[model samples]
Target: MGRHSRKGPKSSGPDIEAATADAGADREAVRPVPGTGRRRRSVEAPAGSDGHTPFQQTGHVRGGHPEQREPGGGWGTGLQQLHRGDDHRPGARPTAQQQAAAGRQQSTGTRPLVPGPRREFVDAFDAPPAPPAPPAPRGPSIPPPRPADPSTSVGERDEQPPGGGTDGPAPAKDGKGAKGRTFTGIAAAAVTTVLAVVVAGQVTQDNGGGTTSAQPSGVDRLGPDGASRSDDRPTPEPVRAKPLSYAQKMAKAYPLAPELKASGKFEAVPGTAKAPGRGHRYRYRIDVEKGLGLDAALFARAVQETLNDDRSWAHDGAMTFERVSTDDPDFVITLASPGTTGEWCMKSGLDTTEDNVSCDSAATERVMINAYRWAQGSSTFGPDKLFAYRQMLINHEVGHRLGHDHVSCGTRGALAPVMQQQTKSLNIDGIKCRPNAWVYPPS
Candidate 1:
């Protein structure tokens, strides 16, 4: 069988050699197209059985050729010989060096022995090239254009409510017509027209005035300064008022007991100030009684607490309440009912004695104020006024003790000196003094 198979392919020799030579010639003749700069794949011999005999050779078109061959004994046949190098023989094992080299190649992402490029004959007769992509269409340039304006009138342009509108004062209405329909329409129109005329006139006047030089109101030029022009009106020397220290400021506000320096009391120990006897160093003995007279005591306590809590008052060491007493105490704090008498007092009636009856700065050195009249709303003045009066009276008597005399209201809206009799009536009589309206020196 082997002998017959070997001999069987002798007739196919000339044809196979001719095919092989043709394939080689085809490869040698292959060339790249001009300007493409790309090389074509070349054709090469197809390995097979029959020991490379030219007589056993075969030929095929690039894409249409069958891939398999017949078994061992025939020309260009035998699948076993076709894939000879790819399969392992029985129990063949890789050498240590070979295995190590393969592992190294894998680790480094590299390999050897890739097949050479296709032969020239294959390149010349390979599959047709892929179709080229289509070209893009050309378009015209469009330059940006101006925005379309809807209307010419500024009012219409801005979509404002009619006639040459403005944000300021409303146009006055014409009072010439009656109060109904046509009157309103006509009046509105007339008013709008008048406003238009006035506005036009003002604009024209302004434009005209810009052309003329007006007389300078000062030694300086009417134009902006820096031209070295002097003003006839005394350039009031910019008297930058010296800023008072926090203490000075508080003292200026409540001069009776100028702001005191902070004692270590509040900060000494956490609860030290609030401690029973230790904290109660300043005992506030409120003289509670029936009648309007006692009301002053309550109000005084409120004032006392307000002053105590006042950060400004506390931080400054000018004064601190050791204790609050009613009468014959270090500081006698007396009160005035709806009707009370004596030198130090607060009442609607005009009475001045050893225990005065009006809320005023008496020469005496103890505090007297109205409690009932101030609370019951029947005071001749407002609570604020009564408060001020009471405050003044108290501070004033204290002032006498401190050696201060009667002083007037010097500031425009500043808190008036405790000695001042700023209230119209000694008692609350007219518009109550607003709490927020403090007295200050007139500018």
Candidate 2:
């Protein structure tokens, strides 16, 4: 339909071999511009009875005329479906990229032309880059696999770093070990301290670079391997305790002290030969709380002079101790008051109201201490170093009533570690000791 007739030139009337056999006698019929009646039609690229040239039957043209040969590298099926729509028909005339894809389908009106996004076979310049995801299968283990002894202390080396550092040991992780259990239940609750949170509940000291301070008493607290005293001098840096407590950290559970007492009945304290025959003798008891003004016989004579003294927790002879009032005592050192030390240290699962902190329960053998860290003692025993914060609160709640477990003073200024938490910060983990209440102090 090459619109032409101003009613005249198609050779002056019509029938040029019936309009060239209705415009398809293999197309090419266009001879009308002599006066301007116009006619231009085209078609060609046909000849394949083996006379070649559909770009010489696909091997890149040789003897001309497949659209004058020249496009041999990309695209072909004879130049995509033979030059698709040489000017697309049915009243054509659009391009300028189909009037910008018709002004984005008339500003996205029912939206449908989309078709352009396919390119990423590795953005094909010849394609081939996509093969790297296969490495995860090692199994069979326990808590011994990571031990080249860089001072092995895990549970993120009891984490108190910054100013009270402990270097970095954290690798013993199992189900949820550390204060909770499982790297062989934190090495079997680090040798007996399976889980006890408020036997006294709290205290602190950090010097590596953070804040919190307070550090006193060293004139003699025990452990030159196990115990022997003559007030061996040099123990002087005393007087820093109390500072840390910006407060506000609660929630894991709190509230207690509806009333309590008993720093009376439990007595007898005398025994030790350092591992004497070696380890296990337990039995204990001591109380206080009735409104907590403190001093139940100076907190039962600083826990019978820090457990018959061989540097406490019966160090060496494997263990031993005895001080009873018999509520079936194997442990019970009470002294409550930060709200009954969060009610007898949440019966051992341990929780909040940290009035400075102290907790121990190995299932309620009860150690709950905190009358605010047995009356003003932490900042890592800094102030009156209440005889080394009552020998680091009776060797950290009798090393969690003998089952043990919290350690980390393996290095820094050394010492500090009657199961380190040194009341709260002692480089919690970045490693930085020195105020140790024994586990082996003296030296």
Candidate 2: tens digits of C-alpha lDDT, residues 1-443: 22211121122112223333433543432211011112222212223344431211122111211111111112211112123323211211111222233233334443222233234422564667668878755632333433332321232234322222222222233324244533445565554442233222332222234443454565444546656454555677879876433121110112333233333232323332222234666666676656454446555655665676676666566666656665676667777666656766677667845434777866766677776555556666576455566667777876776667777776877667778777777775577876777666666
Highest TM-score: give the candidate number: 1
Candidate 1 displacement at residue 247 in angstroms = 27
| Model 1, position 7: C-alpha lDDT score | 19
C-alpha lDDT of residue 113 in model 2: 27
Most lDDT-accurate candidate:
2
Off by over 4 Å in 2: 1-280, 285-312, 321-325, 328-331, 339-368, 371-412, 417-438, 441-443
> lDDT of each model, Cα atoms only?
0.34, 0.46
The TM-scores, one per candidate, come to 0.26, 0.19
The per-prediction CA RMSD against the true structure, in angstroms, equals 35.3, 36.7
Off by over 4 Å in 1: 1-285, 288-290, 293-297, 306-315, 324-328, 343-366, 376-397, 411-415, 425-443
Per-residue error for 160 in candidate 2, Å, reads 99
